[model samples]
Target: MLVASLTAVGAQEGPSGITQRTVFAPFDPTQRGCHKPPGLTKELAYVQENEREFLQGVNHGLEMAAKDRGLKYLRSVAENNVPKAVEDINAYQAAKVGALVATSSDPTAVSSSLQRTIWSGAFVGTIVPPPATLLLNAPQYATGKALADASINYIKSQLGGKAKVVLLTQDTMEYLTPRFEAMRDAFAKTPGVTIVADIAPTPVNKEGGFVTMSTVLLANPDIDVVLGGDAVVLGALKALRVAGKDRPNQFLGGIDGEPEAVSEIKKGNSPFKASISLSSPVFGYAMGQFAADWLDGKSIPQAMDILPIALTSENMAQYEADLENPAAVYADPIRKSTYLKMYGNICYDTRDQYVNFPWSSESSK
Candidate 1:
């Protein structure tokens, strides 16, 4: 029998005010893995570091999960290197680690290697981008649309539906491209919304965003809106301030509710407005729990969703509260439900159900 920790979170509400995108698969927690538990020297390796506060949350979740499972934990940073990610997995495999958690590592790049890890008899869990024993994702289209709706509302209510916009994107990510595309679609329908520049920075960081926006400012000096990941958008905020373009009418927003973005939103008058945050720590902890489950020969969810919440000054406090104490917040029937969606189970007997490519929770919807 599966023991209930706290209480079962029924259907939870996401930032979109609908069902929170959290999903998981049913597992018999009472079971244990076929492989012998790792000896004293072995560890459970977390494949990559998710940088920034968002990923810091993930790191903490993994840590908390490790502590809860009483597993020696190891972590390495790939810094986005596919080969390094694979090597790290192999290193853990060689050590005969009981399980692995790959956080936001490229699924396409690491799919073959992850599959091999499973073949080597190790349990795996993946987040955001995945193809592992356990997977979590938000519906990309919905993710994009949610952010677009936020921007559209701001454009109409604040900017009067007329503004010069700059879109900084990690366009190389196929799943995330919809965010930019949705913004474009919304802008197309609204008159007086001119896209000043839509560009991808080389490094996809704050500095890169600053450099790119500085150049874009050379021609489009009147940019009043900016959209993209928080790192890039925050960089653009710096550029706009230096250029003396951070005006009251200007609006800025992005996904990945970095702390900086939240601070900006709290400013009340700053152009930095909204962010779509997937509570990495909360979901990461859930992922860790799932990882522990998989290692114990328990069935695990093949896929789940960490739904994004659009954070503004108004809702920042409550969200922060949830983040600060994810366990307590998740203990709540409602919030917990949003973060824990269960699907069909996967066990050693169902290893074929282990995902090895880009899997979408939307498919099960």
Candidate 2:
């Protein structure tokens, strides 16, 4: 499960007399002022799950934010090890780090320590699942729909509305299951599409995608559309290439706007056509800025949304530029809005209201 069960420190009414929901009210910074005096804490730490490029972008943004805001940046890669992630958080907490950002394969294993960091008057940011002063999440169903619609359109326009599709999924991540659900919903509407394989790859990586696709190909030798996260979809592309079954007109789309996926899309004739992006650098920079704000007795959003952008060759250059200079993008409201959305407010004084449940802006409806 992506979201850990609520602890004794569960949700409470905010200063505005409002209870927490999937979406939050506009931030009232005045209610949550600076947690500490300026310069008392200057360290921003990250407990990374692995060396995926999506996360490396977050690390890059954090480092840049640290340099710009006069804070020290430290990082520990858990490398998908749950215990290592716990140890890293404890070590950072022991050092009294001012701000912490973390991504984990298993969040419950680290939620207690994360809560401790929050109770210690420090900024805690987590991707998706909570126990964070500033929680970041994507609109899961919408993200999946974007990629699925793109592939569906291709199937109609290029494949004459009839195609065999493979859906590499992450059904194991309960929070992320909506992505595949959305895909299934969209494909269900397309009468000409047949999902030849709907399976979650083991380990959910490139190698896993390769292995899963290899197995799927054994029974179904033809696949015209492949949709999933960038990592696995890229792996599926490799498997198809190896099997000599990849076609110029086939549509292979993914989420996470990964670099390799983009490179594949830029190939013009390649099957990789689209990638839905949750721009990490832009959000990472925002998180770092919030860290600085918290240390300086300022108010920051209690939660943020990393808006998804469907990447294509048409917009690849500008996206790369924004990724490389996320600080600049964060400084510009218009550009930043394209990648992120902010809600509510929390500072040191009001952090008791930190998010402790699975939150999503989509559920606001």
Candidate 3:
């Protein structure tokens, strides 16, 4: 389902018809364009743009992991601007940080800046959007389709597959656009399903979602199905409730397992039915640990597969536990491996293979 932008583990099929992928590859950093650096400084800096509950989980894990590893931590917001991020990273590199844990809305726009940060001898880690030594994101096409399946299933179970839909998309972030496309594709064949308002909210936040949905409701008040990330969808839900449109017939779903979205689903009576759980804190902790490992001259996962876990009432308890305490989960050897798919050990010695944006089609054996 998540086909595009994915480099599968190779054509190794198992009993379940699932392709067991080889996401790991041997990296040779001796051919790097940048010079080498001294040992790790036992310090990492976390840089992000937005202030969503999802990112809050990430930063929380980073802070926790920094504490676990006995490392000092620094953090800053880049405001989602390429030039601003460039300048911010320049400041961090100058300070000689050992690792930089980061995420970006536009990896393409900030590619040069990130590459330079890695070149400055600081091991860089990225989530969702890339161009770093360590990159993490749910496989777009697959994760999107999975979320769509949940929404489509909900529509069939509750709304008779005949409902007006609103798709709030984050299509500008290249990898994430496929999720909205999956939603469109899933509802395409279903009869009586009408997509009244298909829009791209500017900020992709609660306010942006509220503003967009308000206008959409004015045009198509009878809309019953909504889809997008937690922030926007929750915002849309607020807008709907304010207009007295929060009915049982209406169904909504989001991607991130934001606290509010999960709470809405837990209500067992709200229009919000599902939010595809990305397990933010779990992955965030993994990224932080990997960042420290790279700085320690240890080989790290060449690539990782962050599979989506659909969060519902039945599974929310454990997911919340994992979110609240990632270190405990990572303590279990088996559970740690399940959270992250490690390919190969990577370090500065493999800087040449230190992933660049628009990752290679093939993983080196």
**Which candidate ranks first by lDDT, i.e. highest?**
2
Quickly count the clashes in candidate 1. 8
RMSD of each: 8.6, 4.8, 9.2
Candidate ordering by TM-score (highest first) = 2, 1, 3
Write the number of the candidate with greater lDDT, choosing between 2 and 3: 2
Question: Could you tell me which residue pairs clash in candidate 2?
Answer: 27-344, 34-297
Q: Give stretches of model 2 more than 4 Å off.
A: 1-22, 28-40
User: Backbone clashes in each candidate structure, one number apiece?
Assistant: 8, 2, 13
Off by over 4 Å in 3: 1-40, 79-84, 104-109, 359-365
* Residue range 1-365, candidate 1, lDDT tens digits: 21111111122211111123333445444554443323313356787744667777877777787778777778888877777887777666656676788754566666655555555556677765555667777666566667777877878897777778898988888767766777788778878788889889878989998999999999999887898889999999999999997797678888878888888899898988888888877877777776676566566666677777888888888888877767665457688666556554665445555665556666445
Cα lDDT of model 3 by residue, 157-246, tens digit: 877767888999999766677777778888897788888988888788899999999889897887788989889998999999898878
Model 2 agreement with the true structure over 1-365: per-residue lDDT tens digits: 11222222332212221235656886664664354732235899999999999999999999899999999999999999999998888777667788999989889889887887776667889999887989898989989999998888788888899999999999999889989999999999999989999999997999999999999999999889999999999999999999999999989999998889989999999999999999988888999998988888788888888888989989999999999999989989899889988888877777777888888888865
Candidate 1 deviation (Cα RMSD): 8.6
Candidate 2 worst ten-residue window by lDDT: 1-10
Candidate 1 — which residues are off by over 4 angstroms? 1-43, 80-83, 103-109, 339-342, 363-365
